[model samples]
Structure formats: C-alpha cells, structure tokens
Target: MTLLDIKDLSVTFNGTPPSPPVRAVDSVNLRLEAGETLAVVGESGSGKTVTALSLLGLNPPEPVCTTTGSLRLDGTDLRTLGDKEWRSVRGRRVAMVFQDPGTALNPLLTIGTQIADAVRAHERLTREQARQRTIEALEQARMPEPESRLRQYPHELSGGMRQRAAIALAIAARPKLLIADEPTTALDVAVQAEIMAMLRSLCVDLGMGLILITHDLGVVAEQADRVAVMYAGRVVESGPAAHVLKRPRMPYTQALLAATPRLDAAARTRLVSIEGQPPRLRDRAPGCSFAPRCPVAVDDCTAGVPPLAVFDGDHAAACLFADAPVELPAARPASAAASEPGPAPTTDGPSPLVEFDAVDLRYPVRSGALRRVTGHVHAVQGVSLRVEAGRTLALVGESGSGKTSLTKLLLRLERPSGGTVRYDGIDVTRPGPADLRRLQREVQVVFQNPYASLDPRLTVRRILAQPLRVHGLDSDEDVLVGLLRDVGLDSFALDRYPSAFSGGQRQRIAIARALALRPRLIVCDEAVSALDVSIQAQVLNLLADLQAEHGMAYLFITHDLAVVRSVAHRIAVMRHGRILEEGTAEDIYASPAHEYTRELLDRAPGRRDAPVAPRFSAAGDTGLSPTTTPASQHTNKERSPLWRR
Candidate 1:
C-alpha cells in the first residue's frame, strides 16, 4: 500500500532582488509504502532535509518560498489541504524527529511535561492520561528508568538519551509515518549502532513508513530498505539499498562510495576524494549540475540535464552515461603525499614533540546550596602518552572518556591536578605570560563544529590573518592566499563569511587558520566527524601532507575508528578517564588487548565480517529475536543476527 507519493516536486527560496532565486529542491519524485525505510543520502545543501520538511508544510514562510507539484498521502493531495486540515494530519498521522535534539526539545520543560503536551495536543487526553502514556512512550523508546527521566529537563540528559527521549515523544501518538534527520550524527559508534537498530525496530514493530535523511552511508547500509541519492537538489540515483550501495550507477553516488572509509579496508590507504564542490542553487548551471565534477564526464553530459533512466528492475540513475563502469581505484596512488614516511616511532625517537608524564586531571564535584566539593571527578588519571615530530597519535573513546580533558591539559585551558606536561624538553607546565604566548603560537586546535570554532563576524581573510597579526608576523594578501591554497581552497573564498561556505569549506578555512601560526602540534577534536566522506578524505590528505612537509604532530581525537586508521600511526583506546589499551595502529586493529576496544571495533559500521551488536537494554537483556527478516516483513520475533550475539 502506497502511504505517500510525491511527483515533480520543486521548492524555491527567494533571494535578494540583485541575486537569482534559489531552487533548493527541483524535479524530484519519491514513493513510500507502509513499513518501508527509504534513506535519502546527501551532503549538506542537497535538499534532502528540505524535501522532508515540505511534506509536513514546514518549509520557511513565503513570498520567500514556493512549492509546486503533488504531495499525496494515502491518495489525499496534501497540497490542496487547508491549514486546519494539515494541522490535523501533522502529528497524529505524520511525525518528524529533527537533527539536533538539544534544539528540538524544550530546554525549560521536563521530559514528561513536554511529551504529555505532544500527546494532549494530538489526542483528547487529560493531563494525567497524557502523563501515563508519556511514561509508556519513554519505556518504548528504551529509555532507562523512564519514571525518573520524566522529571529531568533536556540539559540534564546525555546526548544519546536526549535523542531517545525525543524519539519517544515523536512516536507517542503512534504516527503512521516518521521522518528522522541525521538521527545518529552526533553519537559514538556503539550508541549509533543502538539508535539505528532501535529506529529499524520501531519501523517494523509499528509498521511506520520511515524517511531517513542523513549523510552517513554506513547507517543507510545497515538500516534502509531503499535509497535515494541526492546531489545539487536532485535525486541522481534510486534503487534497492544494497544494489545502489554495492554497484552505484550515478557518478556522484559512485564517488561517495569510493570516498567512504571502510573498516575492512587496509589502514593508511589514501581515500578517493571527488574534486570540486557542489554547485550553488542560485547558479543553476545549464547542463547536469554534477557534470562539473563527474569523473566520467563526456561532451554529451554537458549538453543538457539527463532524465532518470531505468535499468536492473527498479534501479535508476540520472546520468547520460549511466551504464558506464565506475572506475573505483583499487587503492589511492602510491605517490600520494599521505603515504610518505613520517618521523621515527616514539619508542625510537629523538625527543618527542609532546609528552605527558603520568598526567592527572581532576575536577571538584560541587553540590547543594552551600556549593561544597562533594568529591572529585577524575577526568584524566595517570595518562602517559607522547607524539613524535610529524607523527599522528589518535585518541579513541566515547563521550566523557577524557579525550577533551586531555586536550585541555595540552592547550593549558586546565592545569593538571598531578604529574607534569612537557614540550620540547621544557617543563613549562605553569608557563608565564611570555612563555604562554610562545606556547600558544606553537600549538593549535581544529574543533568539530567548524562554524562554532570560527568567529561568525570575521571574513575568511581576517580569520586567517588574525593569527599572523597576533604573532607579530606579516598579514599580506599573498600570505592569506597561500594559506587558502594549502587547504585546497581558492582565493575567491577570501571575501566570504563562514556562513557562506559549506561545512567542508568552513573546515578548510578553520584548518587554514590553524596553519597560520606555524604550530608544531595540532589538536584535532572530532574535526571531520560532521563532514561527507569525500571532504573528510580531502582534509585528512591535506593534514597528512602538511605533517610531512612541516614535521608537525597531530593529537587526533575522534570516535571514528575508520578515520583514525587512515591518519594515525599510534592508537590509544580510552574509557572513563583511563587508557584501556595503547599500541601501534596495526597492532590495535589486528588484535586489541582490551574487551572494550574489541567491542568498539565490532560495533563499527561498514564491516563485512562481524555485524554490529544491538545495544543491551538497561535490564541487561540482549533484546534479540531468534530469526531475521526484511524490515517490511519483520515482526517483533525477528531481530538482526547481531542482536543474538
């Protein structure tokens, strides 16, 4: 039964009079059946999110906006519906789980109150009745201690818990359809696996049609039944999830696959990055927007936009040469700069670039009205690590695992409670102002959220030049241009603000700023966690090249094991402010000594050998069914085989 159908859908956002209007979503078609999971995969600005929003009449206000074509739900034309009619259908029939739970949830309200309100709004329920259902909903979402969580505000919960609570609220009234946007973007590998499994299970158990919008192909592979690949506001490819993922026909889709790092793939292999950026919506190139970056482009590809051609049953692609083979590289070229040798291993090193001799970081846990220090939160305890010049040391852990705290020690943002920190054989643990200035000049950081890391008010030129100016160095146009060029950006980006650039481009700008100070060691805190694989590969390659050329060391902190495998020489597995295991990257990957590290490796997506284990419930149950089945046909009795383990 077709639950939702959309055809020839186009959405345009009005720009200033001097600029052309932006067609964010153009000429797209999609169909969803009950219990179907359709993953919409794309980078930022691909219009996947906008398309999802339009289905619920949630697009930004007009005359700044206009949407055309048909959106039918169960044979009812949604476009013809009045505001009151739409409101009736919005939550009771269709519900949406937004990207950021921190923003989606009401910060001021308790979890129970907020969910009760959602239920009350959609159903004729009293406060007590709504509250009862809210508890049930929380339990259904697998939230631990549902009763206690009801009284807690959004800020009191962990990120994963907050998301789960939000999902509970969305599913409270038992909507027939659900749309989740980047549901697991901010979670760790284990948590992400759990969330994906939970969502997949919900779709099966409730028989809900799900439209999942995200850039993480791994999640799509693990959870989706079908896939739609979007690029520059259009669906470039659509097919069975496995078929499209294994043998993508569109050049863009092919590039995305090749760019992603697989856990099964060998370590330190250079990633295949698609050159050039996606076209701006306002530009609206005459030919296929992707032709500008297509690896297999031809003269015909530039003539006109190709209509989607069908092949292999339901599979389709919008490329003139859709039948052409995708020439995915067996491995990145050996001549690639990332493959070059770095300085000797720390064990055989001249003095290490940075060192921590049994460093301990602790925070006083205050409580009550009197604000007494009840106890200490040992953020980092007896952590000893070293990074040789031009080498990379990766710190892998879940949230609250002391990764950030350790970096704070390095940045001098927090002083150690015990032990010592040394740099270049100097015990400048408590550096004076002049020493601190010198230390700051030699150490830099690239944060996860590039926009937040960058000053919003500063232009690209000023952002890059500020570090130079602070260091009493020349801030010439040539210097700024050179910085941009080093990070694979052009001179034209100089005049733009961080808001004007894409997530990938903004990260590059941040990297440029980090490089401006000629830092000896760079601390990357989940730096590429939010990027598309292609952009991530590009940035990793750039970092490798910089390290090779300048003898810079990287203290790489991230939850992504695949990325860590690509860049790090040594690996440290941390948990609860302690290093569970530490060894050469190869050693750790081949054979992890700690059970926790092994579990982390097992949970990493994109692996063919071992399936990710479903998270054990708070009650310590495996939550597995004896059998497995397709999502559409799955019953509560059928769970993924990984769950059985």
Candidate 2:
C-alpha cells in the first residue's frame, strides 16, 4: 500500500531584486510504500532534504523557500490539512530523524523527557505511560541500559548513542513512515553497521516504510529497495536499488558513482573526481544543474531541462542522452581489485619515520566518594605500527576501536600507560614541555568536526595566526591571507568567521593552520567523511600533492574504507583498543589476516560493480558476509572490478 506520495512539487527561494527566484525543487514526484526503503542519493544542497521537508510541510514559510506540492499520506492530502491536523499527522503517522542528532535533540532536557514530549504530542497518554514507552523505544534502538539512558542528557551520550536515542524518539509514536536524513553520517563504521542492521530489522519486523536520505551509496546498496538520484531539486535517475546502481543511465548519476572512492579499487589510483561544486538553492543555473561538470554534456544540455526517461528494466534517468553511449573508464581495473601492491616506496627512505612500539593506553573508570579506580578502560592495547615519511598510514576500524586513542598517543595528547610512541629515536610518551611544543608544531592535527575544532567567534585571520604566535613566529595579516589562499580560500574569506564557511572550507582552513606550523607529521581524524564527493576529491588530491612536496607522514584515522583504499600506504585494523592486524594497504585489502578487518572490508561502500569477478580469500574474512550478491543492479560492465585485481 502507498504510505506517502509527493507530486508536482516546486520550491522557490526569494532572492535579491535583480535576479529571478532560485528554483530549489522542480516538478518532482515520488512514492513510498510499506516495508520498503527509498534511498535519496545526492550531494550537498541538491534539494533532496528540501523535497522531503516540503512533503511534510515542515519548511519555514518566512525567510526560507515556499513550497507548492501535493503531499499525501495514506490517500489524505497533507497540503490541505490545517496546522492542527498537520501537527497530529506529522508525529503520529510520519516522523523524521534529522542529520545531526546533537542539534536535533535539545541539551536542556533529558532524553526521556524529549521522547515523552513526542509521544504526548500525538497520543493521549499518561506521563507514566509515555515514560515506560520511552524506555522501550531506547531499548528498541539498541541503546545499552535504556532506563538510565532516558535520564541522561543528550550531551552525555556518545555520537552513536545519541543518534540511536534520536531514532528511538522518532519511532516512539509507532509512525508508519520514517524519514531518516543522513542518519549515520557522524558515526563510526562499526556503529554505522549496527545502526543499519537495527534499521533494517526494525523496518522488516514493524513494516515501517523508510525514506533514507544520504550520500553513501553503499548504504543504498545494502538497505534500499528502490533509489532516486536527486540534483538541483530534481530527480535525475531512479529505479530498483540494484538496477539503478548497476546501470546508472543519467550522466550525473554515472559521474557520481565514478567519482565516489571505492574500497575495492587500486590502492594508488587517483579518485575519479567530478570537477566543480553542486548548485546552491539561493542561485541555481538556467539549464541542467550538472551541466557545468558533466563530461559528455552538449549544447542541448544547457538549452533546457531534460525529462527522466526509461533506460532499462524499471530504471529511469533524466539525461536527454541516457542511451547515447560513450566509453567511460572502468570504475577500477579488474586486476587492481584483486590485489594490493607491496610497500615499495616512491623513493628510498629511512626505516619508517614513526613507529609505535607495543603501545598501550588505559584510563581509570572512577566511582563513589573515594574516587577510586575500580577498573581500567583499555583504549589502546599493545598496538605497534610504522609510518614511513611521505607515506600515509590509515588506521581503519569501527567505534570502540582505539583509532582515536592511538592518534592521541602519537600526538602526546594522551600518555601511554605501557610501551612507547617513538618518533625517530625519542620516546614521545615522556615528551618534555619543549618537546611537546615541538611535537605540536611537527605533528599537526585536523579534527573531525571542524565546528568544534575552530573558534566560531574568531575570524579566519585570527584562527590561522594562533599557531604562528605559539611558536614565536610573527607575521602580518597578509601572511595569514597567504596561508588561507594556499589552502584554496580567497582573500574575501579572511575576514569571515568559522560559521560562515562550509564544512569543506573549514577543513581547508584547518589544513592551512596545520601547515602554518610546518608540521612533519599530520593526523587526519575523519577529515573527509563530512564532505561531499567533489570536495572530498579536491582535499584528497591536495593532501597527496602536499605529501609529495613536504615528505611528511600522515596518520589518517577514519572508518571510511573507500578512502583507506585510495590514500593509505599501510593499514592497521583496530578493534576494541587492540590492533587486530597491521600490514601494507595491498596486503590488508587483498589478504586481510584478521576476522575483524575482513568484516570491515565487507561493510565498506561502493566495493561491488559491473564486471566484478570472484576471488579466493584464503586469509579468512570470517567477520564479513561471504555471499557476494551484485551490489548495484544498474552497474555497467566497463568498470574494472577490485575483487579480481
């Protein structure tokens, strides 16, 4: 049965007097059925979320764009419903899980109270009844100790735990439809897998219809029954999840897939980046939104918008020339997929520049008035690895793994309880004040959330100059501007604050700050996960170039296996504060030794493609699913398969 349907949707944002209003959403149409998932895949500001918001009449009428559409839920037109009715239908029938749980949840209230509000708003329930259901909701989301979690504030929970609580709140009313917008963006890979599994199992058992909005195509392959590609507020391509993915008909869709880093590809091949940025809702172009960067665009593409047309077997693409074929490079060479190259350095180098010699870190779990350490939380245990100068060492694992803890040890942010962190000949764990200061200068860090790392009140100039001042180095405003420019910012941005910049721009600023100290070692913690495909490409390339020039070592920590495949020289798989396995990127990819590492490889995005071949995995990836189902049904045969490389 059709749970929700949106038809003839259009949204226009008000602009300054000179230009026409920006069209954020065009005549879009979509449908959601019970017990199925519709994956809305797009880059930032492509109108995917805007469309979803419009469907629910959730957009702010003032300041923001006004929407015109027929939004129906179970044959009742939502647009015609009055405010009071909408208030009832919104939470009772359809609920939303926003992107950032931290912001979505209020800090002042306990999680229990927040969920109680949601339940009470829709259903006529007693305070006690709502509280009991709230605890149950938390449990349903797989939260540990649900009863205690309800009393805890949002700030008290970790990223993953907070998100799970949010999901539980959304489902508290037992809504038939759930809109999860980038639900797993801030989570670690392992946590993300758990959440995905929870979502999948919940939907199946409850027959909840799901609208999953995200950038991760891997999520789509695993969870979605159908998929829709959105760009410039328009549906560019769509079909059964497998079909659209396997054989994307739209040029935009094809570009997106090619550009995305695949974990199964060659270790050193440059990312297939689609040049240029996505269009903004405030000032979009007149023609095809993707025309500026499309490789096979023609004059007709710019003349007017093309209608979505059928390609094959339920798949449809908006490109006018969906069937007009030209040769596109295989996604990855088949050979590149099956094997990883050895650690043959680009140049003859001294033994790895940085090595962790049996590193172990532990923190005391305190309790009661005595404040005694009851037991220790083993954050990093007996981890050893080497990072060669000019080479990138990617530490990949799920949450609860000691990836961040290990980086902290390397940077001396945390003192190791056992073993040592060696940089050249020195034991960094016992760094003196002078040595620590030098380490900060020599080993810079780019934090995961640019928001928290940067001072929002400080302008770009001030932010960039703090490190310079710390090291007793003085420079004029011009020098700050130069640093900003070096990281791809313009002089105009120098006066702006952190809040004014996008995530990608903030990251660039962070990188510029790291470079200001002229660091020899750079630590990247989930640096590119928040960015869209195009911006990720630019940052990855810039890092590679800078590494070649500076001969610095990079300690990259992330859950993204796709990026690890492309950028890492050596790979260390961590699980619960222990290094499960450490080896060259090629060996880890082609022949992972540990079961945890194998499971990670399976959960990675964009690994399966057309022309994929079966390969023997004698190393035993016991943690991963052995069944090799076709990842995307619409994938073309031209792309090289990483499995057979």
Candidate 3:
C-alpha cells in the first residue's frame, strides 16, 4: 500500500526584497509504502526537514509561506484537510519524532502525563486505560523501568533516555508511519544501535513505515530500506540502501559515500571533503546545486538543472555522468583545509601526554541545616593512567561513569580527593591560580552543543575574538579576520549572530576561538558526533594537522568508539566510574585485553579497513603496535595502570 505521496511539491517562504523567497522544497516528489523505511540524508540546510514538515501540514504559515503540489496520505488529499481533520491524521496515522529531544519535551510535564495526553488527544480512554497504554508505549520504545520513568520529568533522564521517551510519545497512538528527524543524533554509538534496533523491530512487528531524517550514513545503512540522498532542495539519488552506498551514481552521492567512515573497510586515506558551503535555498543555483564543490562537475553541469534519471538496480541520479565509472575526487587544496576548517576538533597525538598518580576525586555529600557530613560517593576511584601528547585518549563510558567528573579533576576544575596529575613533569593538580589559569589557556575545550556553549546574543567575531582578548593577545581586527579565514569562515560571517549560523558552522567558529589561545591541551566532549561525515573528516583532518604543528594533547570524551580508533593514540575504556582497560590504541583496537574494551571496539562505525585507533603507547606481550614515543627517555608505556581516578 503506498501510504503517502507528494508530487511536484513546491514550498516558498516570504521575506524582504533582497532576500529571495526560499525555494525550500522545490518540485519534489516522494512515495512511501505501508511498511518500509526511507532515509533522507544530507547536511544542514539541505531542505530535508522542510520536506518532512510539509508532510503533516505543520509548517507555519507565518512570513506567509506558500505550498503547491499534491500531498496525499492513504489516497486522501491532506492539502484539503481542515484543521480538525489534519490534526486527526497527524498523531493517529502519521507521527513525528523531532530532533533535539531535550528541547522538544515539555519541562513541566511528567513522562506519563505527556504520553497520556497524546493518547487522550484522539480517543476517550479511561484514566486506567490511558495509563496502561503509556506504560506499554515506553516498553515499546525499550526504555528501562518504564513504570518508574513515567513519573520522572524530561530533565531527570539522560540524552538517550529522553529521546526514547519522545519516541514513546510519538508511537503512543500507534501511527502507521513514523517520521524520525535526527532521532538518534544525541546518543552514543551503543545507545544509537540500541535505538536503531528498537525502531527496526517496531517497523517489522507493527507494519509501520518510517521516514528517518539524518546526516549519518551509518545510521541510514543500518536501518533504512530505501535511501534518498538530498542536496540543497532536491533528491540527488534514490535507491536501495546497499546499492546507493556501494555504487553511488551522483558526484555528490559519491563524495558522501567516500567521506563516510566505512564499518567494514580500513580507511586508506584522509576523507575527501567537498570544499565550500552548501547553496542557500533563496539562491537556487542556475545549474547543479553541488557543482561549486563537486570535483567531477563539468561545464554542462552549470547550464541547467539535471533531472534524476534511471541509473542501475532501481537507482536514479540527477547527475548527467551517473553512468560513469566510480572516481575518487582529488584531495581538497591544503591551505583550504586549514583556512576553511569548520570546527576546532580536539586533535589526536601520535605521543603520551598526561599521566596520573594515585588519583582519587570525591565530593562531600552534606545534609541538614547543621550540614552534617554524609558518606562520600567516590566519583573516581584510585586510578593512574597516561595520555600521550599530540595523540588522543578516548574515554568511553556511560553518563554516570564519572567521565566528566574525572575530566574536571584533570583540568583542576575540582581538586582530586587524593592524587596527582603530571603534565610534562609539571604537577598541575595543585598549581597556583595563575598557573592554573595559564594551564586553562593551553587546555581549551569544545563542548557537545554549540548553541549552549556559545553565547546566543554574540556575533561570531566577538566570540572568536573574546578568547584572544582574555589572553591579552592579538586584539587587532585583522588578526581576528585572519583567524576566521583560517577556520573556513568568511569575514562576512563575523558580523552575523550565532543564530544565523548552522550547527556545523557554529562549531567551526568554536574551533577557531579555541585556537585563538594556541593552547596545548584540548578536551573534546562528543565533538564530531553531531556533524555530517564530509564535515567531520574536514574538522578531524584539521585537528590532525594542527596537532602535528603544535604537539598538543587531547582528552577526548565520547561514547562513539569509531572516533576513538580514528583519533586516539591510546584508549582508556571506562565503565561504572572505573577504568576497565588502558593500553596503546593498537592493542585496544587489534588485541583488546579487557572484554569491555573489545566490546566497545566492536560497536564502532566502520568495520572494514577501519582506521584502528592511533597507538600512542606500546603494549607488551600482546605485541600490539604503539604510537611513536617522543625523543625523551624515562616515559614507559608498560608502566602501571594505577594512577588516579
């Protein structure tokens, strides 16, 4: 049963004279069956979400947007549906799981109340009946302790859990089609897999059609049956997931494929990034939307729009050269990599950078008006480890595993309960305020969400320049412009507010600001997890080059093991606030001694020819290779793992 269909769909948003009406959804066509999954993959500003919003007639009419073309669901024309009729179809037949679950949920509402309300929205079920359905909904989403979580607010759950709750709500009415927009973007690899598995199972068991909107190819490869590769406002390619991925026809599709980290193959070279930003919706290109950055784009490509034509094996590509042989594009120019690096990624080192000695961190738990001392919860147990300089030390664990707490201790954000952190023979754990401040300058941080980390009211120039201002260095406007230019952001962008920039662009600005201090340490918290593959590689390569030049140390915190292998020189596997394994990246990747470490390595993204984690430390007896050791002596990789936790 073809469940939903859209043909010649065109949507436009009204704006000022200079700003052309946004051709957000330009002459698009789509079809979905009763039980199938279609992945709409693209970077930011690709009009993927715009098309999704159009499906439910949920797009706001403000600025007086216009929609033309046919939109039908189950042979019913949704465009002619009145407000009441449209609302009836929204949750009862078609549902949506929006991106950013944190913001999507209502803070004041309990999980049960929210789900119950949705169930009650369409049907008149008794309180007891509604409650039962809510519990079952949570269970269907695979959220643990569904009953207990019903009373919990959105804030009480972790990012992964919150998204699951949202899924539960979306599925409460048992819709025939589920539209998930970046649903798993906030989760770690293991958690992402868990979510994907649940969604796939739900589709099979319930005969539900799924429309997944995301930029991660791995996610699409795992869960999608059919893939729609979107560029600007058009679908560049559409076919079976395997066929589209294995033999992409369009130049943009090919680049996207080459750039994505493969789960089965070893990465042979630096990923090829399509240089330059995506085209604006208001400024539709005269020819191909991707021509500016496409390596294979010929002169004819610029003449007019290319129609998506049949290629092979149920695949269609808009590119005229879709039948051409597979060709890998040349590497983007060098200065381009540095000058245009979007986000400042915490670089990986090929050497050991940080060492811990008998480390223990505990926060005093107090209660009562008298503030009587309560039993202390050990955040980090007695732990000792070494982090190679210019290399990455990936810390993998769940939220409560005390990952951030341990990082705080290392950064001197909190004094350890008992232990020492040594950096190149300097004990920074108990450093004076002045030294600590200087240390902070060298150890910059790139947080998970760019919006929360960046001041919303501030312009790009002000944010990037503020770092230099605080350090009492390079205050000249030209210096700031040069810095912006170095990070692939144009000077014109400096004048715009952070709200105007996309997630990836804001992240780039964040990287540029971090570099303003020229620090030696960079602590990344889920850095590239939210970015597109092409851009993730661009940022990753920039970090690699910067590390080669500056010899900086990275304390990378992520749940994604794929990134660990790609960037880490050494890896310290953590579980339940304890380090499970510590070894050179090679040992961790090739011959993981600990079962936990092996489990994490197995769940990483690319499986074939995957770039094994960088080996910053040599492992003995195991015979695993190590990252290069510095010229200095006395530093041993075989040293005891006991330092400080």
Candidate 4:
C-alpha cells in the first residue's frame, strides 16, 4: 500500500534584503510503501532533514517560510489540512526521531511518563492504561528492563539507552510512518549496527513505512531497501540500494562512494575526494548544481536543468550525460600516483615532539553540597606513548575510553595527577610563566565540531589573524592570504564567516588558524568525525600535504580505524584509560595482539574478510600508500584486557 506520497514539493525560506530567498527544497518527488525503508543521503544543509520535516507539518512557522506542492498520507492530502486537522495526523499517524536524544527528551520528565504522555496525546487512555502501553512500547524498542527504566530520567541513561527511549516514545502510538533523522550518527559502530537491525525489525513487525535521513552510506547499505541521493535541494538519483551503490549513474553519487574510507580498502589507499563544496542555497548555480565539481561535466551539462530520467526498472538519474561514458579522476593511470610524494620523513635519533610517561589523570568524585571526595574518576591511567617529530600517532578507542583525557593531558588543559609530559625534550608538566607561553606558542589544537569551534561573529581573516597577533607574529593581509592558500582555500574566503562555509571549508579554516603560529605539535581531536565522506577525504589529504610541507607532528585522535591506516605512522588502541596494544601502523593492522583491539576491528563495517578482523597491507603494498617503517621495529608486548564494569 502507498503509505505516503509527495510530488513537485518545494520549500522556500525568506532571507534578509540583498540576498535572494533560499529554495531549500525544489520540486522533489518521493513515494513510500508499507514495510519499506527509503534512505535519503546527503551532506549537511542538503535539505534532507527539511524535506523530512515538511512531511508532517513540523517545519518552521510562516512569515519566514513557505511550502508548496502535493503531499498526501493514505490518499488524504496533507497540504489542505489546517493546524488542528494536522495535529490528528501527527504522532498518531506519523512520527519523527531526531538526531540527538539527549536534547530531544525532557530532563524534567521520566522516560515512562514521556512515552505514556505520547500515548495519551494520540489516543483515549487513562494513566494506568497509558503506563501499560508505555512498557509495551519500550519492550518493542528492544530496551532492556523496560519496567525499571520507566522511572529513570534522561540524564540517568546512557547514550544508547536514551536513543532507545526516544524511539519508544516515537513508536508509542504505533504510527503508520516513521522518519528517523540520522538516528545512529552519534553511536559507535557496534551500537549503530544493533540500532539499524532493530529499526529494520520494527518496520517489518509494525508493517510501517520508514524514511531514514542520513549521510553514512554504510548504514544505508546495511538497512535501506531503496536509496535517494539529494544535492542542493534536489534528488539527483534514485534506485534500489544495490544498484545505486554499485552502479551509480550520477557523478555526485559516484564521488560519494569513491571518497568513503572502507574497512576492506588496502592500507594507506588515497581517498578520491570530490574537488569542491556543494552549491549554496542562496547562490543556487544555474543549470546543474553539481556541474562545478563534476569530473565529466560538459558544456551541455550547464545548458539547462536535467529532469530525473528513468532507466532500467526504477533506476533514475538527474544528469544530462548519465548514459555517456565517463572516466573517474581516481581511475587515471599509475603515472598520476607516482607524481605525488608520500608521507613526511621522520628524522632518525630526533627528539620526540610530545611524550607522555606513565601519565595518570584523576579527578575527585564529589558528593553532597560539601563536595566531599567519595571516590576518584580515573580518566587516564599509566598511559605512555611517544609522538616523534614529523609523524602521526593515531589514538583509537570507543567513547569514554580516555581519548579526550589523553589529549587534555597533552594540551595541559588538565594537570596530570602522576607522571610527566615532555615537549621538545622540555618537561612541560609544570611549566613556569615564560615556559607556558612557549608551550602555547609551540602547540595548537583543531577540535571536532568545526561549527562549534569557530567563532560565528568573526570573519575568516580576523579569526586567522587573532592567533598571529596574540603570538606577536605578523598579522598582515599577506600572512592571512598565505594561511588560507596553505590550506587549499582562496583569498575570497577571507571576507566570509564560518556560517558562510561548508563543514569541510570550516575545518580548513580551523586548520589555517592552527598554522597561524606555525606550531610544532598539533592535537587534532576528532577533527573530521562529523564531516561527509568526500569532505573527510579532502580534509585528510589536506592535513597530509600540510604536514609534509611544515614538518609538524600530529596527535591524530579518532575512532575511525580505516582513516587511521591512511595517515597514522603508529597506532595505539586504548580501553578504559589503559593502552591495550601499541605498534607500528602496519603491524597493528596486520595482526593485533590484544583482545580489545580485535573486538574493535571486528565491529568495523564493510570489511571483506573480517572474521578475525580485517587485515591491511603495509606501505608499498597498495596505491597512494603512506610512508612507514617495517612492522618489526616498533612491536610492543601485548597486555591483558582491562576490566570494565
């Protein structure tokens, strides 16, 4: 049965004077049937979420926004419904699951109360009846101890538990359609798989339609039945998951598949990054929105907008030359790979850039208003690692595995409770006033969440100039332009703010600011975790090129092991504030000696042979390999897995 139908739908948002009104969604058509999952794939600000929100009249109020076109649910047109009429359809017939559960659930209410309230809002149910229904909803969501969890608040639950509770609330009324917007984007790989499985099961058991909005193609491959590729507020491609994923006709879709770092890919394989950012909604380039970045773009591509042309069965693509033969940039001859230089060479007998010697960072667990120390929080314990000059030391672990604490120790954001931290052979554990200034000047950081890290009020030029001025370096226009150019950005970006740039461009700006002082050591804390695959590849390559030119050392921290193989010279696997295994990148990838490390590797998705965990070849074994020493030199004795309660 056709559960939902949308045709020629367009959403427009009003902008201030001097800027044209933005057409956030333009003439998009979609259809969903019962017991089917349709995945909408795109980067940030691509109108995926906006289109999802418009389905149930959840978009922003009028005076600033307008939505037009045909939208029907079960043969009834939703566009003709008034506010009061739509309320009956929402929550009872259609429901939504937001990206972040922490912010979605009310902290003042218990989990059970929220679910019960949702039940009561849509149906005629007493408190006791609602409570009973809530328990059943929680049970169906696959949440354990559903009865006991009823009284617990949002803060008392783990990240995974909170998301499950959110799902329970959404399904409380047994809505016919469910829209999950990046449901597992914030979850670990294992938990993500579990959630995806649960969602698929729910769709089958409930016999409901599902629209999943996400950027992770891996998740789509694992769960989605059909796929829609959106770009600049348009569906560029639509087809079965297998066909679109394996034989993408649109260049944008092909680029996304090529740029993603796969677990099965050989170690140090250079990711094929799409050259430019997506078109801005305000600008909305004429003809094809992807023409500027399309590798096979021709003059005909820019002549007019191409409608979605259907091909074999349900497959369709919005490209003027979808049927024409085209060669991908990455598929060029081996001579192209030979021209690019490898990773920066490390100096023999050189001083370590940053060293942590048996570091232990502990905090007192306070209770009551008197703030008595009841126990200690062991954030980092006996963690020892060496980051040599001009090399990348990747720190890989799950969330709350002390990755951030380790970086904090290196940044001196928190004083270590035990052991020492050395920088350039100087003991920086307890630096004096002048030493602190020197440490700050010599070390810098680029954080995750580029939008949050960058100041919204400051222009790009001022942000890059502030660091130089603070360090008493030249802050001239030439210096600013040089910084921008160093990170593959043009001078035109100098006048823009963070809001004007895409996530990838904002990260490049962040990298430029970090280089303003020419720091010897950089702490990149989950820098590319929130980016799209193509953007992540672009940023990773940019980091590599910059490191080779500047000879700077990097403490690259991330949970993405596939990305680690491409950039890290050494790999350290951490669990519960302790290092389980440490070795050269090649040795660890080929054979991890620790059980915890093996578990992490096994959980990685898209691996060809992952039973004993995927094995990656060392340098010189694949194309675009990063430079590395033989595995025998840096192998360390494996330690027993730490206890986690």
Clashes of each: 0, 18, 42, 0
In candidate 2, what are the lDDT values of residues 25-80, reduced to their tens digit?
A: 88888888888899998876677777878756787684556678788888888778
User: Which 10-residue window of candidate 3 scores lowest in summed lDDT?
Assistant: 636-645
Best by lDDT: 1
Q: Model 3 segments beyond 4 Å from truth?
A: 263-269, 329-379, 411-431, 475-488, 605-645
- TM-score of candidate 4 relative to the true fold: 0.82
Q: Which stretches of candidate 1 lie over 4 Å from their true place?
A: 81-92, 106-116, 124-169, 333-337, 340-348, 426-429, 474-508, 609-645
For candidate 1, list the clashing residue pairs, or say none.
none
Q: Which digits, one per residue and each the tens of the lDDT, describe model 3 over residues 10-93?
A: 888877787678877788888888778999988777778888888888877756788889988879988898888888998888
For model 4 the local lDDT of residue 633 reads 16
Off by over 4 Å in 2: 15-21, 81-83, 110-113, 124-132, 144-148, 188-190, 280-283, 311-314, 331-352, 369-374, 422-437, 459-518, 605-645
| Superposed Cα deviation of residue 575, candidate 4 (Å) | 1.6
- Model 4 lDDT, residue 392, Cα: 85
Candidate 4, residue 189: lDDT: 59
Model 2 superposed RMSD (Cα): 8.5
Would you estimate the TM-scores of all the predictions?
A: 0.86, 0.82, 0.84, 0.82
* lDDT per residue as tens, model 1, 1-645: 899899999999988899889999999999998889999988777898889999889987778898998999878898888899988888778898887677689999999999998888888998889988999988777777899899899977765678788888888988888999877655678777876787777778888899998777777887888999999999999989977887777877876776776676567766666666677788778888887766556678778999999889999999876776444432343244445545545555567778998999988967789999999989999999888788889999876678888988888789999988887766657777877888889989987656567888989989988888988877887778766755557788899898877555787788788878878889998777767776776677667666665678899988788888888889999988999999998899999999999999888876653222112222222111223211212221232121112
Q: Which of the two candidates, 2 or 3, achieves a greater TM-score against the reference? A: 3
Off by over 4 Å in 4: 84-175, 329-349, 368-371, 426-428, 456-462, 474-512, 609-645
Worst 10 residues of 4 by lDDT: 636-645
| Greater-lDDT candidate between 3 and 4 | 4
Model 2 whole-model lDDT (C-alpha atoms): 0.74
Question: What would the per-residue lDDT of candidate 4 be over residues 413-466, giving only the tens digit for each residue?
Answer: 888999998987777777788888999998999876566679999999899888
